[model samples]
Target: MNTPNQEAPAQNGKRRTRLIALGVAVLVGVGLYGSYWYLHARHFEETDDAYVASDLVQITSEVAGAVTAVFVDDTQHVERGQLLVQLDDADAQVSTAAAEAELARTVRQVRAVFSQADGLKAQINERQIALRSARADLQRRQKVAADGAVSAEELQHAKDQVAQLEAALNISQESLRTTQAQIADTRIETHPQVLAAAAKVREAGLALRRTRIVAPVSGTVARRGVQIGARIAPGAALMAVVPLDRVWVDANFKEVQLAGIRIGQPVELHSDLYGKDVNYHGKIAGLGAGSGAAFALLPAQNASGNWIKIVQRVPVRIALDPKELSDHPLRVGLSMTATVDLHDGSGPLVATQLRSEPQRVTINEQRDAEVQQQIARIIADNAGHAAL
Candidate 1:
């Protein structure tokens, strides 16, 4: 058996050994964490306060009408130019018909004016020939009367006829001038009256086409508020189209963490919905002009007596690769975690220029082409052929 004093010393030695081992473990842990911060963590900024965002294209009516049909519902995928809704088009159709008839009538009236001018020109030519004939006869009669072979009465009658022909020629020339003035320097298509009528026709056609609401972009429908038989007015919100392919991330970072952030930095993102299995790659597109608090509806009044300092966040826009987005789609307002690489500090903190072109441009395909065809048909039917 060992002595009591020897046992006490042995236990104290064991305690000292344990203390040494714990100290070494702590030192190693700290060193590893420090190395990690220096090599990687320092060159990046991360935030979980990010979300997918896209242009929420609102669908609104350009003309007021009662809803006749709802072609799409919530979450339906629609292509660009596909019809989404239809309004009662009876009034629009009647208006378009009236405009079309007016255009046709105007074309005929312009053609008639051209015809009248040509007729006046013909009358002028005929009057000139008559005057020439009358002058020749008068000269012959005067020559004969001087020789006593022609009677004075016959000679006087010839002179009177020549005078009458000259007066008639002058009247015809004046009439031709008046008619030419009405149709001067313009074709049937370019006439002011015809143009005015054509404008009416275009306006009416646009209204008629507006009755059929089409998708402005290829997107999934959301927030559909219209119903059948609902009377909607111009600018009323019917629904929204969210183009998933055009989505970007809006990451909000604290003010203290924004010093190294810059445009064009590479970003890696993870959506909570997809978890860490799927990673998204993007680049910083821009930085917000101000912090979120500054743009809030009820901004904090820091000047008041009850002021409390709070960390503010600024939004950073990150544009994703279109191909990646196509393969892995994202919806607006989805939560995401973003990590931006700040190794390259050679970019601007804010964009100094605007985009050279618009991101998107939507045109009403049906209204423009259909209206043109209708106008051409009206002109062809009324004026015998379409204007070149």
Candidate 2:
């Protein structure tokens, strides 16, 4: 109904609207992708290859023996100092009895040595008196011979008696010196021989105690390799104690992802086992010194004729809450996904940069008083019986 030029204006107006819509769509698309890139810049920090790990102490026999009893089976929960196994203790008992007998013999020998000192003193006094009597007799015989009452032979015999007495006195004096020297040389308190023998007794006692294998840590046992009548030796792997409370996650992060990573930063994790139903709370405890492959048995030989560049990942240790770990027990090597918010980059990249060594194990301050009391009771019991 309108002219051609008027219709052209209408078409131009419609074209402008379409171009505006297209421009708006392009801007929104660009903005969305940019936001995505910014949010996931540290995606490498959240690794799917991360795993839960903890210190696994392998229990082994310190003494060689045939296992007589296995108190714990695989997956058994044990407390520290709880007996785990018992070896054939007949041999250990025999050794302990022999050591006790040897200790008693040593005590008797020391007492005898002390008594011999007194006996030697008495013998020395007797010899001194006998020598004086012999000298007096010789003088009397000489005077009597001059007066012609005694024969010259009798005087000579008296002189000979005095000479023999002198020899006997010298021998007695030498024996006294030797006995006194021995008394001075022998020490009742920790003499070398006594120490050597005491060490043997201690060794025997330790061996006897080892016959009853005890758990070194409080945890659940796994991978048990012991059975009744099984012979074991030192350093042999018997069982493993997995302390769930001490479990931590080791996340390998790319080098680029660590630019904003800081110690004490909070972490949120979800394990595959839990399927996002459970959330774990943790903090960045530390960073590994080097890549994992660097610690492998057969490391890559980069110095060879052929070499290729590979992206290495560094391990970051994250300490989880004990409550969380206990609530949801995680086995070693369980896969997990972790996210660390790096919004606060003011914190130190390290934990205190401390030169001081961290204590691997610590005594609970709350239980110190109780532990001391128990230790005191043990000492009193031992000292009260045979303090001497």
- Cα deviation at 167, candidate 2, in Å, is 6.8
TM-score, per-candidate, Cα-based: 0.93, 0.71
Among residues 3 or more apart in sequence or in different chains, the pairs in candidate 2 whose N, CA or C atoms overlap within 3 Å are none
- Runs of candidate 2 with Cα error greater than 4 angstroms are 1-19, 25-45, 121-173, 183-186, 275-277, 296-310, 343-388
Q: How many backbone clashes does candidate 2 have?
A: 0
lDDT (Cα, tens digit) per residue for candidate 1, span 1-388: 9999889999999999999999999999999999999998999999999999999999999999999999999999999989999999999999999999999899998898888777778988898898899899888887778779999888888889989888888888888788778777888878888889999999999999999999989999999999999999999999999998889999999999999999999999999988999899999999999999999999878998988899999999999989888877888999999999999999998798899777664657656888988887887789864332
Number of the top-ranking candidate, with lDDT as the measure: 1
How high a TM-score does candidate 2 get? 0.71
TM-score of 1: 0.93
Worst 10 residues of 2 by lDDT: 359-368
The lDDT of each candidate is: 0.90, 0.76
How displaced is residue 368 in candidate 2, in Å? 22
